[model samples]
Target: MKTLPAQLTPFVRSDVTGALLAETLGRPEEEFSLAELGRRIGAGGGVVHKEVGRLLESGVLVDRQSGRNRLVRANQGHPLYSLMRELIQATYGPVPVLRDLLGGLDGVERAYIYGSWAARRHGEPGEYPNDVDVLVVGDPPRRELADLAVRAGEQVGLDVNITRVGRDEWDAASPSPFIATVRSRPLVEVLTEASDG
Candidate 1:
């Protein structure tokens, strides 16, 4: 998880907004319903609704009714569309990308980014991290997880290292040394069940 250029951080307000922009406007070719967009970005409907409204008013997003649903998409014609997309990519792309890539995998319960990237995200000053370390709590196959990591890494332009653990191992009353160590560090959760328990 490399720190996005310091200059760009100020321009991007919330991660939720950035994620929405990156997924919709950044892709430009895709359209998403409001509920779908909220789920994809790991944001509640109200938050997504508010941000979408703001972007819509700014002419950065366009929404059209399709049957029973309203599909929202990037306003590719907007003059600042390209610049905004680039900024979202550099600042808030990874978390949503990772969430979309790994969230619904069979058996995946939760995913967290733990390491230098998490540290930087938590506001500790440092150079861009060279890699992203991910902790996956579930029983998904190694090959499957590896393939996902590769794809996610390609999307974010970072090396993604995944560590997996079974539910019992992850939720034990007394955590193992490895789990304890991970828990002690700064962690940016990527995907989690609706109920954290």
Candidate 2:
């Protein structure tokens, strides 16, 4: 793994660390195995293992060996657990929160975060995004989506705007200039066929 510069002291640490913490702390009651964390975070097992070690040492996470598998979960008893959870959730919560929300809606075939936030996530150096822009492809109810966006925004501590479009309108062959422009830039997938439906 590449080392971060000595002067940098990000509260969330590496992307792998932030993502792993989000998954565990998002659902504090749920326990996850190391391999499962790696799979869920789309990171290498060794990378996940190293982050887990750091968390364990810091008392931010707790672990136990369940027969052959080692399981880890949030250490809710830690002094800084609540504070850290809030910070991590607000920063790294979009993907998991959006995925969980969109997963409940039957008509949401796909969902993505585009614009500035996506650009930054894609490694473009720039200012932090002021709002999160989401594009949903399918027929999910607009009113429900609006309400969901509000809830997601509250959790993320950033404004979340949703733009819903039918599957046809979102297709590459479609003539929508908006879709065309979005396709030309970075898009972070929030929901897709690969994840659980």
Candidate 3:
């Protein structure tokens, strides 16, 4: 076994992280030896070896090996992967329908899943969302916002109620009563914020 590097914090590259994650998601949770993972991603064998070593050291993966072949999985109990899975399941599920609806909205910043769906997915809520509550920020025309919500609702089979607020509203100590209503829902998403503008 190679001795682990003493100082690899700043050296850990995001591109490598992305490549690993992409490769993991590309397959259906099939375990791969380090070398096999490297081949799949077009990375050199040594590089894959090092990356796998780092991931194993971080407790982000668990593995069993036969000879040189190793099988690895994202640690189910690992906090990061758990959270990532939850967010991915929620966002990629019904959220895309809503995201498509916001396509033409100018000044739209970003969308956040903040309410019941998020709460439930993140384990903040005891129950899952029955409907979707979304917060829209930006300068989208009112009609466009309404239309988006309607389309999202129809497509995703959820009651997609969208609340529009400006970036300034979020910065205030307290948002308006209207925003408060959306926030109070079992599930809510702050679909846009100032930084997204």
TM-score top scorer: 2
Return the clash pairs for model 2, or none.
none
Error of 3 at 108 (Å): 1.3
Q: Which stretches of candidate 1 lie over 4 Å from their true place?
A: 1-8, 42-46, 66-70, 119-128, 195-197
Top-lDDT structure, candidate number: 2
| CA RMSD of all predictions | 4.4, 2.8, 12.5
Worst 10 residues of 3 by lDDT: 1-10
By TM-score, is 1 or 3 better? 1
Residue pairs of candidate 3 with colliding backbone atoms: 109-196, 110-191, 111-191, 114-188, 114-189, 115-187, 115-188, 116-186, 116-187, 116-188
lDDT (10s digit) by residue, model 2, range 1-197: 22232111155567678778889989899999998888776788888888899999999899999999999999999998898888777766788899888899879999999998777666566777788999999999999999999999998889999999999888758658999999899887888767655
Instruction: Tell me the lDDT of candidate 1.
Output: 0.78
Q: Backbone clashes per model, in order? A: 0, 0, 10
Candidate 1 vs. true structure, TM-score: 0.74
Query: Where does candidate 2 stray beyond 4 Å?
Result: 1-9
Estimated TM-score for each candidate: 0.74, 0.88, 0.45
* Candidate 3 residue spans exceeding 4 A from truth: 1-92, 177-197
Please report, as a residue range, the 10-residue window in candidate 1 with the lowest summed lDDT: 1-10
